[model samples]
Target chain A: MAKQFDQRKETEYSSRDLETGCVITDPGNAARYKTGDWRSQRPTWNTLRCIKCGLCSLYCPEGCIAPNAEGYYEADLYYCKGCGICSRECWTQAITMIEEEE
Target chain B: MMTGKRIGMESSLGIAEAVKLANADVVAAYPITPQTHIVERLAELVANGELDAAYIPVESEHSAMSACLGSAATGARTFTATAGQGLELMHEVLYVASSMRLPIVMAVANRALSSPLNVWGDHSDVMAVRDTGWIQMFAENGQQVFDLTLCAFRIAEDPEVLFPVMVHLDGFHLSHVVEPFYLMEQDVVDKFLPRFRFPLALDPDKPLTAGAFFPPGVYGEARRAQDDALRSVRPVISRTWREFEEISGRSYKPVETYRADDARVLLLTMGSFSETAMLAIDQLRERGQQVGLVRIRLWRPFPFTEFRQAVGNAETLVVLDRAISYGGPTGPVCAEVKAALYSEPKRPRIVSYVGGLGGRDILVSEFVEMIEKGTALAESGVEEELLTIGVRV
Candidate 1:
């Protein structure tokens, strides 16, 4: 479960009148600002190859890959910065990288 | 609440005992004399299993403070001690600690700065870092050393004020001198200081970035916030002190007065010298001289209101400083005191006198002479702003 921001009566996180340091209210808010737009190459999973060894999930730098209802791991596009680490880490050729369109 | 055994002990050891009793989670320090005794005893405590804290003996003062920053960011109760050049070396990290609002407590064995390689006691080191945004306080005796060390944790960790605090003791004078002081029981310390709980911690379940870089657009706001936070901690400091007083029955104030009720001349001092100056004030009073003592215990967030009240009805205020401001002013304390009272409608003429540099003792007799000279200077309306006392002519 994601942790919630601990707000108290004493603390007033004013955007206009700041009296405290930088604080992020939403947990995992980094995902909100999608980094997929920064990608030059995108990973395309070849599910037909039929190998769920989970190496792609293990080696993913952004932790964007997770198992779907079918029990096969897929990339979370919102944060997948398209780093192709999963494609490179896959022991079986179950994933491939393709050029991201501008 | 004061249940611990009373023992005559070296002041530095008393400080170490307080840190141990506070149950500090991390202690990172590099050895520097006057300050060495504190970390040395702390190391012994950790090694002997007396303290359950991680003791990091880093290679340099810079890395020591850097380690403390990391430890504090991890939501641990962190501490470190350094002196003179060591403090100067860690000067940059000091700002990072305060700006990040890491509640790390540091004990600075106040010592004279080096050019002549002197290692004696002076306020030059502490004065050098006066504006680094850390909450600063001076301990006048062994008892204050123990109590204030413990109090620094409470003041720094309070949710209302999470800024780091530095508790200073005069080097060799307070650090090495053996004095009898009361030690509160561990249970009492626990009652006074609750378990450390940082609002922002580096927990895996609740990950959030800390000490992030601020762009030019938002940088000014961040700095202004830090300033506001420092100013806001004043009441928290008083509240923390008052609570501790209830537990220990030992009172403290930022601007403490001694015999200044009905006086024409007052001598201002700080740290351990205030006690010595009290005796001098007694001597002056015996000879029918109306004199008193005003000691500044809190350095930063400089207590302006209490200081003005302490110097009430006095015609001349003799400001004694152990550190010089080089070419700027006679003494930093004198310069600050003058600035604090500059706006008041009724204020005494400030006589700037610099003495007791590099651990040289300021005799009791010299205190009387300083009062006379200062009163004379104030009366004659001389514009001389600086005087170096005890320097060979």
Candidate 2:
């Protein structure tokens, strides 16, 4: 076959570095990993300290925590990355729950 | 009848002058602090058209390296300069430049890394990029830099060793030091190192693909090919360095072994620290200590065979690494040397000395202190953990 109008193949899988380029060398697989919303069984906590100190809600980078009944803290485990920063940050140490198997 | 004055310049600057002398086709760079002088002067040469090269102004160090890759692939003899963070930023392209087999030459001013952030003399930067497959050279002084800078192009462009080369100098020490050297005449340089023409390049007529994607099925094979190419570079490095000596009247070797012929304790070092270590060795010699220092010039290939042969008679091998592996006992070189020496039945007892890291000053006396610490371990006949050379606060 005669080659015509050759162009630089735009490889856009975007780990952006060659060392681990294989982590996303396959574009289709890379897209899946990117948009394939992860599932996690992280612990949800009832902040029984109940002092209503909004620290837990504010400190969660994931924003998984919110004010529940009586202004205690509650975590929505569905989207939590399970980084566990929330449990460690609870000043009163009122929230504790075990993780579930994946 | 005279022209430009004969002067020995810093290795990085020597490379810049040689690149200018070679009339490189492209000089792309991001302004990495320590490695700035090479690119800076090269930029001046380009501005004046003494060197007919495209001076690519890149935004980041990674882009700087990528520009060289692109330029070299397009059949231009491309060049670049970088240091610690810059080297880290360009880290991704280091292997690509090798696998694609572009004969790009770079000047790396070996500098300390950051956290506290320092811009001083050390091997931290180049050591961090140890296995990136580019032919790396350590200049002992300004003269080596001027000579090796020219030799680098000859070696990298040699069809047999068509790999990139990084001429390394310590940040402030060799990169900034001035010495006297017989500068190669431009016509002589042109005669010795001809224009680079890559056999496999991104030419329209050839329509070859480079840095292409490959599946897991063949990824390991491709890497193996790279390893094979690099492993075979030792001989090429020797031959080219000899050729360089023949033409330029300057000499070099893979590893420069000093006072090691009959020595019992051998100290291994890279970059500017080796000079200081030599002073320490002199002191130790006067004091009746059986010590010598081995300066590793060709780093990437690591010169395993030559290194093993060089330090053969030594009873104790003290490796002084400027950068720490964080968790590993020795600096990066010691670990690899251990792995290289693992199969050998008889080799020197290895002890690691970590010092001059993070821009800390490594004095000649400190080298003496390290030898004392190391020989102590050898006397006890125990393989000690990492030895910190100048760690006292």
Candidate 3:
């Protein structure tokens, strides 16, 4: 049986209060943890030359790219590591890699 | 107390029988000398319809322990057997099994490390893994090995104490020796050991991440939690032993003493040699020498309280170690014993001796002689740091 993760900050929990074996009881909890802060580069899509072949979404290492409401694909900056794989593999040169802004 | 029919069997086979009784779910092991017979017999049981368990014959000891880790993480009762070099091969994975809190029971046929290429019984392997974080227990005889192996499953699988356990028996000494011991009935064993249920097991429907990456921020806290969990398992070990005793007539203790009530001097030993020391103690007692014997059954978490109480009153304690520390102050076990008694207000004068290495025999006369020499050394206040017994000069 899976146990529920206690709703407390990791630093706030003492040794005794932590889960046994440091097991993260909440399944799929990684979605809640943001990794976009680790990005050194950002991916920008070019709408003019865009062919919504969805290859960018398919090749995302983090699987963080998806289609926007206008039927064009975009990278979800919240979870993306911005490895530039989408820009490197774009079929129609529709994506560009740019340095992440401060 | 319900006891099954008494039968003569090799200690390794008895261990296999104990695993069968415990109904272990998976046994992943590679054959290593002195420890081969255990897995061989287990493989045979699985080959037939007797065990009904998955016997994974791994490529090496490293994979053996790694496979056990996967099996145990899935909430399966797992077991494995290894020896000197084999134990060292799986050294790194031992930490993972304890840190992840998987209740894997391992049988170690204690053997001396290789260099001289000896496949004999010694505590060199056991001493090497002393800090690996698994609860360790040494068995003095075939009966104790069988009993402790059975108890290991119950102790490790306890939800409150979800750490691995190592049941150590001397290679070729206890593992190869054939002895008759009362085997508990299957129904009695079933009643004694509850079905294991790991609360946070890996399930596809309920996916919880185990052994997640702990950065520097939380790594210290995780280690502290593991340390506290290990130190707190002594009570569960005792309670499991007690519950096992209630069903079967066999009783066990952390630190067992023999004829030590009012003895002035005591001899301490572990593993199979403790039995021989007992005979030496009896001989000394018959000759009007007030001597006794103390055997340390529990090694990890170091049974500090029980050990202190067992050796507190003795004026001199002769500690017999089977492995050398190689240029250190004394044998590994002796150093620990001295450290354990250091803070006590009234502690015994400890004389350390390292012998019986690489499967060499330490005779009863030698034990008697060592005790007398230790007593003499303590009485004379001559501080000889380390003494090697039974060596031809």
Candidate 4:
């Protein structure tokens, strides 16, 4: 039906892997333990705007988000289905699911 | 040999007979062109209480597939049927049924795609969802359709297989065609298809979550489990087929080759078109053409080994695809078959074709035309005809 195509989101926020600085392979539900793929559509945070509340990590039902070596929150989006619970639950404008086109 | 009697009936009725005999717990489906009769009779049986099962009336094919998944997950045996746009609409959930490891069965009345809008028999409906992770089978006659529908449940519910099955039949041609068949008494079918059991199930006392979200760390295991399940089911499928033969006096295999034992050319097809090709093969043989036909009865978990053995030795391979791939050189089946053979050192000379678009006719005469076109191309060594056959108007 036209309704299915009508709900399409053209823009997706692209996230870069902090370790490799490469794009994530699977922004949502990517394979485990693989080379970084620019194809991943993950969300990157501006840590300065983050308050260390850990809301994003807690809200991620997929548990893809965890603390980095620096104790800063990070998301492992390979298993993320882009449910958008993370961005919606964020108190600060720090967490956002950006579209690629945007 | 166990003696049995056959009675003539429409193929859809035969399927309904088999479904009743299978003693499935749930039959849920949305009606679509060419496949309505199957679910209609099924609903009637449930209404009359002649059969003890829940016949779910669904709004759309999507919901129908979802209901089957729901019933199947609860450890209830479930089945559904659809065609053309209905199959396409259920495309998203088709993979879900397989991935969730529910052994649901579906009868797909093969039909055409839209734009011009025609409702007849073709492979376009099933072809679109070929990679949906379900086990797929194609049946030629009303008899095979009945035989394979039973075989579908056995294969799908086998602890090893734990995969959904799609028993595909040509819309109208087979779905509505009348033929002779022997209906299995409920007792025999009960012995043949046992109640489904799943090691993993949602129980109120020992609750378990399904379709849980997994991160990258855990996703691999689920997929690996699925792949391994498919591989492990090979032996189970064979055993089930043997058991079915013993119980119902019928047998089945992954790939069925006709008159190919002594031949140079092979005609490969899936669905009712194979029947047309069978007729053509007979005519071709009479005319001194060493032509044989290979029908891919089982498409998914494709009989790669059987396919190799059947077409591997042919001097010329002409694969007739009843659906178009748009930009591809071959239909979905031919492309996969070619990929499977590319690794072999002594592959047969192969030519691809795209025919019978929009459920247009793939007549026996057209198959004769396709073979002639293929032989000429083989002589000149061309890649393919790209697309041909079927009616222009």
TM-score of each: 0.82, 0.77, 0.90, 0.79
DockQ of each: 0.14, 0.02, 0.62, 0.04
Q: Choose the strongest candidate by DockQ.
A: 3
User: Candidate 3 — what's its lDDT?
Assistant: 0.91
Clashing pairs in 3: none
Cα lDDT of model 3 by residue, B1-393, tens digit = 648788999999999999999999899999999999999999999999899899998899999999999999999999999999999999999999999999999999999998989999999999989999999999988888999999999999898899999999999999999988789888888987868789768889877788887666568888999999999999999999998888887889999999998999999999999989999999999999999999999999789999999999999999999998888978999999999999999999989999999999999999999999999999998877779999875
Q: Between prediction 2 and prediction 3, which has the larger DockQ?
A: 3
Q: Which residue runs does candidate 1 get wrong by more than 4 Å?
A: A1-19, A23-102, B1-4
Off by over 4 Å in 2: A1-102, B1-11
Q: Model 4, which residues run further than 4 Å from truth?
A: A1-102, B1-3, B391-393
In TM-score terms, candidate 1 sits at: 0.82
How would you encode candidate 1's per-residue C-alpha lDDT over B369-390 as one tens digit per residue?
8899889988999867568778
Ranking by TM-score: 3, 1, 4, 2
**Each candidate: what lDDT?**
0.86, 0.76, 0.91, 0.78
Pick the winner on TM-score between candidates 3 and 4: 3
Reference contacts preserved by each model = 0.23, 0.00, 0.81, 0.00
Clashing residue pairs for model 1: none
Model 3 chain B: weakest 10-residue lDDT segment is: B212-221
